[model samples]
Target: MRASIESEDRGNSMKEQIKYGDDVLEIELPDDIIVDRVAPASHGGAKACHSLRDDHAEDTYEYLYGKIHQALIHASTRIEKCGKIVIACDDNTRVTPVKQLVPPIIDFADARGIPAEIIIAGGSHRKMTRMEREKKFDKAIMDRVEIMDHEWKEEAVFSNVGTIHAGDESIPLLLNRIACNHDSFLMGIGNIVPHSVAGFSGGYKILLPGLSCEETVRWVHYLISKFPSEAILGIADNPVRRTINSVHQHRKIDLLVNTVLDGSSRVVSLCLGNPITAQAQGASISRRVHGVPVNTPGDIVITDSVPESVDFWVVAKAVTNTKAFTRKGGHLIVFGPCDEGLSPMHGDALKRMGYDAPRNIRSRVKGGDIPREFLLEASHACQVGEVMEHCHLHLVASGLDVDAMASIGLHVITPARASSFVRELIEITRNEVTGRKPRVKIIHRGAEILPLQ
Candidate 1:
């Protein structure tokens, strides 16, 4: 809604507009080559409970409250004591409509005579600003319900909830104190997307990286950093997901109100139930919404990390799913507008290791070349390195530290210069190649989809 997509023709050339932050990128492609693009698909935007699905009734809250009420009633059946409940919501880094859906949860709590509060499971991202909070929940909802952000780094607020073994490693599980409190019934709200971590985001993930302590978060990230991007990016079930589930079981989560979003981040489907079964059901719908089959590979592929575009570290997620879209020896461009620069938390960590191959980084970590504090981000760097090895990777990032990006092996181009650069590159590549027309495909909002064959 911020800006309209406009297209035009310049004699045997194609110009298309893509959104970057608030600015529109008017990229023109040489018509001599084959041009194709695909975004994440949307369902009819239905609501589901258990195995049942239905159209969005006018009384959306009734369906939400009914399922929640039934579950809560069932949970409280034998107990006489008045219990407390907590609704853990995802931050703006995800496309989840946490603000819109939270009020109804509060109403459900009130009706059940249980005190309720909302915790933003930000997962080590920057704290949400007062302005951001206001925009997220509006003033009325903020005043009506208690809302607070999870302090992942604040050691005082975390509790060591024992340890769990993932593969051969036994890791200490530290989680948010409030979330781990047995007195509070947990209701986690999030959106499901094909994720590099946790197989897909939702289910028990609201506890793992979402509300877990700093070290625990780092451990999970580093654990999966061992695998190549293609090995785990779009997979629905993987080692990392199983590990997260193992860690999540330490805390008791009753209900998971997970959603599936379209390319535009609209809630295309809503799922309600416990984290395990509900999440499995939810991811199936998410796959349908975000999965795009690709029989023909593209010579040039572009993707933008919409759900998390704050910095190069997070925005590089566009490269995760879209890697499959780029054919071997093709070009991949990622538009990452890093508003937070490199990272607010990891000081010079990514800069120190930069982005490189997985085997090299793993060896460096083993040899203690990378500081213990930076191992978490080193996993992310491995992803970028994996992309660089297969194809020519270009980053169209505006706020990245240019010198650091260069040193780290990223071919970064500013948004202002991206159009001309892409056009010239396409023309040059076309001139050099013969027999077959090269393919150009741009995936808008790449964070959600799995580009499947």
Candidate 2:
């Protein structure tokens, strides 16, 4: 029921002309930019509780336009028709400037002799569906930007295949797929959260599902969260990581655009050029003001008082990764308000993991044992739901009493202990050990922390 579409009245203020050098050009944009950010219907509590406005919306748009415009200028004056302009984006928005707003603005610029074509940075993700694809372009600009025929280029890779043993079903990890196949070109990614695996943001993620297959998306998401190599760092050099990068290198990536988000998800800093290099610099800046350091010591660190405006996806990312900032023995304190634990697609993946009730628990207790593969399948499922709640429903519907956590390989800390209550948990953890060194790490990634952009 929130405002999914912005009206025209909100977009009318910027019709004037401006001069840069001797050439004068008019800036044109929809007065009200309608944004429809999707949140889970059943478990929207965590993200819904936070403020719902895009605090950095205006600045993000301006920066995006500026980058395209600058690139257009360079392409027009210096380069020729053979040149390409690629803009990398994610599911964050259906309305893209290049596909929706830029053509008209560029037409005005073209009056001043600048010409450019916007190509979808469909490097490594799935293509949008009919309905989802419609929001990206109007009739006119849709013609201007070229949509790649398909999302991924299928390629077979010879590697050690392993089975993700979820429940009883063992899914195989197979070959690699590349999204875009360009020899060499300039690349610019929009923005993303600072993840442990990719290190900061804006590498080749915008195209993940959009370019990769369903299984590919599943594998990448699963491994990034549960794998051990992440602790060592520079895991990008690993075989799986290198293979993914090789696909991008094949595209001849030249420049990278990365956006830094404040705790409030505002665009505080924008870094241009060199994806990895820019991300390192931008992420460092992001942490200085918004990142809460790991300083406290507790068996279970409960992050209470989370603001409502933060999305569950970002919330899950922050809490799930708390271990990275926490001492080994400590558990995480998640104050998530949502009851539904995973995204819709992610939930489906979890179900596919095959969590039938275990024989032992089915007869003795209400709960069931879930294999690690089920956990891996459901790892990214923690969008906002409690795993127990989801499991309970699944069990009752399927007429099963209990499940095992081991079979699925997912280690959920649900059936939350009574001691987990923030006040009690803190007291217990704090009081247990004598002369215990306080070493706790808390990251304020949710909406509570103000956005730096």
- Top TM-score hit: 1
TM-score of every candidate relative to the true structure: 0.92, 0.51
Residue-wise C-alpha lDDT for candidate 1, range 120-156, written one tens digit per residue: 8888788888888887777888887889889998999
lDDT of each: 0.75, 0.37
Error of 1 at 191 (Å): 0.8
Worst lDDT 10-window in candidate 1: 1-10
Candidate 2 C-alpha lDDT tens digits along 9-79 = 22343332222112222323223221111111111111111122334335456555665456545555323
Error of 2 at 77 (Å): 5.9
> lDDT, candidate 2, residue 296?
33
The list of candidate 1 runs beyond 4 A from truth reads 1-11, 49-70, 73-82
Clashing pairs in 1: none
How much lDDT does candidate 1 score?
Answer: 0.75
